[model samples]
Target: MASTKKTTAAKVQAPIDNRETFVSLQKSFADSDMPVEEKLKTLYQLQAADSEIDKIIQLRGELPAEVAALEEEIADLKERSAAISAVIDQLNRNIADAKLAIAEHESIIEKYQRQLETISNSREYDSLNKEIENQELLRQIGEKTINDTRMEISSKKSELEDLKDRLSIRTEDLAAKKTELENIVEETAKEEAVLRERREECAAKIDARTMSAYERIRASVHNRLAVVGIYNGDSCGGCFNTITPQRRVEIVSNKKLIICEHCGRIIINPDFAQ
Candidate 1:
């Protein structure tokens, strides 16, 4: 007798990469039987998304520069403080050395006086007196050096205190600026992300030739507006140029792409303006 074995098939899933997804989207747009008005609508939607992104960027104007300026100021202040501290340290060392020199001079003068008491002749006593006089002069010089260094230390400490105060104020300012920038970024980040995705989807729906023309027109225009709808039922929204009846009829038909001669902006029917 022969036994039959049961067989099962494993299900395999195919992975889709980014390139495949992009090609699929491209094919859908190319082969779409959608009306011209729909395509123009998609293009206008892309422009609107891009404009919103631009507004978000504009809202953050000069904050980056201000933050950088604050950072630089803080660094300069720290460097100045360090330099002043080094000067103060050197001055303290100078004062210490002057005090040590004065002590040595006093010891030498005491030794000279002892020698004067033991001198056997007047000439030797006179020589001892001269030695003591020179040591006293050295002590006076050391005392003057100590006094000068102390005065310098006092002035530098005052300057250091002022710098510290300024640094504290600047640090507070920097913190406030950073917080403001962070808040702005946090507020706009998610909205910006969603708009970017919408812009990409809209861009994918537009044909390559139209997209290229749109980009060129947007770049050449002051407000980066490439597609504008009719305004006041007769004038171009972008340049305020009067749209002839024929042009208005052509634009409303959506049979072909039309651009304003004055501003080189693509014109759509007034109904499409949002």
Candidate 2:
């Protein structure tokens, strides 16, 4: 009597509204009658697609980080520039106050001198002279303070100019870098999206158990290679380990999954790799 068992073709529905559910896709592949070789081939395709995505990500290396750093630096520069401007303003105010003090001292000296001319007593005359001397000293001190403040303002202005020049150059650099990063991201975004869709499609066709195994191996491996082909008809493609005649024949037959003993990578015939 012939076997009554029936094999059902694998049916994987595309994502609804462009939204994919990994659980549903996994269950679909798990319940399907997809052949083991077909599953391995699908895994290989997925790996290739994912590897391309990896390359795309690598191409964008450090650009985002650089953009962030430039932004932070520009912000810090602007803050420092503002602080310097504030200092300059305060120095100018101080200079103005010093000038006012000098004027007040000069008026006091003039008043004391006029009082000295009117004093008849020697004691009163001496007191007026001392008052005039004190006022003159205060005027000299105020003048010195104004001069120091002006020199400081001049120095601050020079520093502010240097900062402005530096800030301008950095701003220009940041703009160029931002544009460059945006262009690269824009170009790769479409390509990556297509590759991702292809990967998901391939994943949906693979058996759940096989997909789980492949993912496990991929995660464990440093280079993310879980599926590899025969190399030179006698060696494993992943680790370059020599394969025995029997094992090589089994791998070529593709009747079942074959793992490399040395590297634990899933081995496929070289023909299937194409």
Candidate 3:
């Protein structure tokens, strides 16, 4: 009758050690079906795969900035090239205008020379000669303007060519980097698939309540571990914190669910005495 009362109290608090429930929950996990060592192997494989996928995603995100920088540099180079081309085009137009002016001035000089040969008075002759000299001066100025424009056009073309070359090289480098990232993702696709499948299987087997507790604690902790094993002298394997004498006795008695006070982890006390 006393044992019956204790059992009734436990049932009122919560179902403790329902063998059927435990077996059902354990069966739910594909990992539980495997041997202890094999379960560890599967867990580790899943963890490693998750870690690799995270690293790959991080690496891919990092590459975008590098690629964007390169693209920006290339765009700047192209803008510079366009600006230089505009300058070159303006210079060429100026050169053409200067040549036209020079030709017109030369025609005026030739006409003045003909008129000077037939002038009747010295004053008129001197005026014609002065007009011819002005035309000659104008023609010389036009020639100098044409030469300067030609030099500017040549310099701009050279600078534009150099910018184009640099831009091409940078674009090629960006393409190569992008290709490398794509290849890495593609090569790891198989492993990623395996990890995802195993994670699904693990999720289905774990009880909702248990998973909720595990996730809550795992999210709060740095180690991401929610379960811990009790070792010698009732110490946690994870944190190595000693359990109190009373708690140890309670845990050994298997009266109810036990948690570590120091780490707040759900403890799985192995029946070491057996």
Mark the regions of model 3 whose C-alpha exceeds 4 Å error after superposition. 1-47, 209-274
Candidate with best lDDT = 1
TM-score between candidate 2 and the true structure: 0.73
lDDT of 1: 0.80
Clash-forming residue pairs, model 3: 28-205
What lDDT score is found at residue 108 in candidate 2? Answer: 88
Candidate 1 error regions (>4 Å): 1-32, 229-256, 268-274
Worst 10 residues of 2 by lDDT: 8-17
Instruction: Rank the candidate models, highest lDDT first.
Output: 1, 2, 3
Q: How would you encode candidate 1's per-residue C-alpha lDDT over 1-274 as one tens digit per residue?
A: 0011322113211112235543453354445566677987887788889989888887676687889999999999999999999999999999888899899999999998888878899998888898899999999999998888889999999999999999999999999999999999999999999999999999888877667767877766666677898988899887787999999999898766677766767788667664
Clashes of each: 0, 0, 1
lDDT per residue as tens, model 3, 1-274: 1112332221111122455644454444333444443443333343444445555566666667777888888889888889998888889889889999999999999998888888899999998888888999999999999888888888888898899899889989989877876776787677667767776675555446545555665554444445555678669754677888887776656434455656655455455322
lDDT of each: 0.80, 0.77, 0.65
lDDT of 1 at 31: 56
Query: What shift in Å separates residue 207 of candidate 2 from its native position after superposition?
Result: 1.1
- Cα displacement (Å) at residue 71, model 1: 2.5
The digit string of per-residue lDDT tens for model 2 on 1-274 reads 0111433113212111122343343345446688756766776788889888877886677677788998998899899999999999999999889898899999988888888788899998988888888889999999899889899999999999998998999999899998998898999999999999999999888776667767876666556677788888799876677999999998787566677766666777678656
